[model samples]
Target chain A: MKVNAKKVLMLTKISKSYQNNLVINNFSLDFNYGDSVGIIGKNGSGKSTILKISCGLLKPDSGNVLLMGKSFDSTEDGLLIKSRMGVVLHEDMLYPQLTVFENLNFYSKILGIKNVNTKIEELSTLLNLSDYLKISVSKLSNGNKKRVSFAKSLLNDPDILFADEPESNLDDNGKEIVSKIFNDRRKRGLTNFFSTHSEIFLEKCSNQLINLKDFENA
Target chain B: MLNWFKVLSILIKKDIKIEFQTKETLVTLCLFGLLIITVFSLSTENNSLINQNFGAGILWSSVIFAGSIAMVKFFYHEEQNKTLQSLLVMPVPSELILFSKSIVFFIFLSISEIIIFLISSVLFNLNIFSLKLILGCIVFNIGYSVVGSFFGVISSKSSSKEILLTMLLIPIITPILMFIIATTNDVIRSELNSNFQTWLGLGISFDIIFLTLMSYLFGKILED
Candidate 1:
C-alpha cells in the first residue's frame, strides 16, 4: 500500500482486542489537515481504543498508524510525532497532588515550551481556570478538572489533538468553551480526532462523523 | 543530549514535588522498615550472638520488604490517576520515565535507609557505619531502584499489584541483596573479607546490567 505523505493521520487495517474479546477489527481511517473528525458509538464500541492507538498510547495488535506521515515504529519517529500531537483521555491525567498551574507547567517543560508561564496563563484564562490555578486538582470539582485537562492538551498548540470523550462531566458553559476551542482549531487548519456521545457536540465541533457501529464485525 | 537532560530534570523535579506534598512514599518506607527492625530486635533481645551474626540479614530483609511496599504505593498514584499515560503521550523517551522514577525512588530509599540504619545500630548494638558499607548501599540501591521501578510499572497493571510487585522484584534483585548483606557483614566485623572485592564487583555488575537491560525493556513494556 502506498502511503499518503500529505495526510495528517492515517490508520491502516488496525485491529485490537482484550483477551478473546475483539474491540476494533481491521479498522481504517484517514484524517487530513483542518479536519475535525468525531467518532460516535456505544459505550463498548472501541472509541477510546481507536483514539489511544492513534495517539501512540496503545499499540494495535495488527495495523500501522501514521501521524504526520511518520509511523511509531522507530523511537525517533515516535517522539517526533508525539511532539506534534496532544491527547485527552477519560482520566484527567493530572497529578492530584499538584496545583492546576503546576501540572500545566510540568507538561510545558516536558514539551520544551520556552514561555511556559505565558502559555499557562493564557490557557488558564481561556478555560476559566485562572481562579483555580493555585488549587490542587484533587480539590477541584469534576468539571474544573476536565477544563484543566483540556488546557494541558492545548499547551503545545498541537498539530493534531486526540481527545476521548472531551466533554464528559463538563457543564454547559464548559462544553461551550470546549466547542469553541475545537472550532477555532479547525479554523486554524489544525486537526481534531475525538469521540463523543453528544450529538450537539458533534454538530458544533466535527465536520466529519464516524459511527463505529457501521464497522462492527468487519 | 541537552534536551534529554532538561526533560529528565523536569520529570524528577515533578516527582519530588509530589512526594513532598503527600509524604506517602517516604513515610511508608521509613515506618515499615522501622517496624520490621523493631520486631526482629524484640525477638532476638536475649541473643547478642544472633544480633551480631545476622544484623546485616535483618537490616536488608527490612529494606527489601519495605522498599517493595513503598514502590507499590509510589506507582499506584501514577496508574490510578493515569498520570503515567499523560507522560507516555509526550515527546519524552520512555526510558527517561524509567530513569526519573528510579532516581526519585533511589533518593527516597536512601533517606529511609539512613533512618532504618540508625535504629538498627541502637537495637542490634553494632556499628553499622563505614565507607565500605556506604559504597555497598549506593550500588545496591541503584540496582534495586532500577529493577524495582521496572517491575513496579509492570505490576501496577495487575489487580494484586502489591503481591505481584514484591514477588517479581525480590527474585530479580537477589544478587544485589546478597552482595549488600555480604559487604555489611564485613563492615560489621571490621575486617576485610577475602571476597570483599568480589562482592562489590557483583553488586556493581548487577547495577550496570539491569540498568541497561531494563531501560530497553521499559519502553517495550510501556508500548504494550
Candidate 2:
C-alpha cells in the first residue's frame, strides 16, 4: 500500500458492465507523476464510468487497477483510494442545505484538516466563494455549486485530481480561475485526468491530450 | 475533541438552517404536537381519574409519535435532494456521520418532548422539577432517537420509506418506551417503596444497549 510518486496508478485491460451493458471494454490506462490526461468520448462512451471505476465507485467486471502497486478490491476500497484523490464528477456533490462556509467547514473537518480556517479562507478567495460563504447553498447558482465541489476536491490537496466536465457550468472568469488552479496544481506535481466530451480543455490547458480524435489515443 | 465536536456542531448548524428556512419537518411536527396536547388537555380537563392515570402515557406517546414523524422526514429530505450521497462521500468515520445526523434528529425529538412536556405539565399539574424523573425521560429519549436513527437509515433506502420507518421503529423501540413510561409513572405516582433502583437501572441499560448497537451497525448501514 506504499504508493510513492514513482509508481502512481496503473490500469490494465479495465472493463465494466452492468446487467449486460458493457460500459468499457478492454480499457487500459496509466498515470505517471505530472501527467495530465484528457479522456474524450461521445455520450454513452463510458467516459465518466471509467473515472468511477478507477476511483472504485463502479465495479469493473474484469481486469485490475493498481495504485502504487496496491489493488483496489471494491467500490468501498475505491472510496478509500479516492479519499486521497480529488474527484469532481459530472454530478453535483454538495449539500445545498449548508452555507458555503459551513460546507467547507464540514468537509475540511471530515478531511481531518488542521489550519482549515486558513485553508477555507484561501479557497474562498481563490474561487471567489467569499461573498457567498454565509449564504445558504440552496440559493447559490449552479455555477457556484460547481465551484464548491471543485474547492472541496482540493481540500486535502491530493496527489491526483480528477475533473469530470469541470468546464460545463462556468463563465469566462470562472474558467480562468479554474485554469489558474489547474496550473498551480501542475506546478505542485499532482497528476490530473480530465474526462470531457471534447479536447478543447486539453488543448487549452493540459500539456498533452489523449484519445481525442480516435477511440484509442494512448 | 475539537474535530468530532466541530463535525457535530456543523451538522447541527446545517440541520437548524434547513429547518428554519423551510420549516418543513419541524413545523409539521409542531402542529401535530399541539393537537396531541390539545386532545389530551380536553379529555383530562373534566376528569381527575383520566388525568392522573393516563397523563404520563399521553405525554410520552405524543412525543414518541411526533418524534417518529420528524425522524422519518429527516431521511426523506435527504433522499429528495441527494444530500445523503454527498455526506456519505466525506472521508470520515461512518459512525461520526451517523451520530451527527442522529443528534440532529435527537434535537428535534427533544424539542418536541419539551414542548409537550411543558403543555401537559400545566394542564395535568404534573411535576417537571424532579431531577430523577426528568433524567429518566432524557435517558429514554437518548436511546429512542439512537435506535430510531439506525432503523431510519434502513427504511430510508427501502421501498416504503415513510411507512416502513413507523412499522419497524415501533417494534424495535418498544422496550425503550416501556422503560421510559414505567420510570416516569413510578416517579409521578409515588407508588413504589423500594423501586427507584429498578427504574434507574432500566434507564441506564436502555441507553447503553442501544448506543452500542447503533455505533456497531452504522458502518454497514453506510455501505448499503
Q: Give one digit per residue, the lDDT tens place, for model 2 in B67-128.
A: 77777777776766656656655544557667877777777777766777777778778765
Model 2 lDDT tens row, A1-218: 23553656787888777778866778877867677777787788888877776654555778987765555554355445656777787666676776888778777876677899899889989999989989888899989988888888888887777788888798878888887888778787777878866455666667656563364442
- Provide the TM-score, chain A, model 2: 0.90
lDDT at B223, model 2: 49
Error of 2 at A3 (Å): 3.7
Winning model by lDDT? 1
**Which parts of model 2 are misplaced by more than 4 Å?**
A10-29, A40-46, A56-83, A112-118, A128-131, A202-218, B1-28, B157-160, B193-203
TM-score (C-alpha, index-matched) for candidate 2: 0.81
DockQ for candidate 1: 0.74
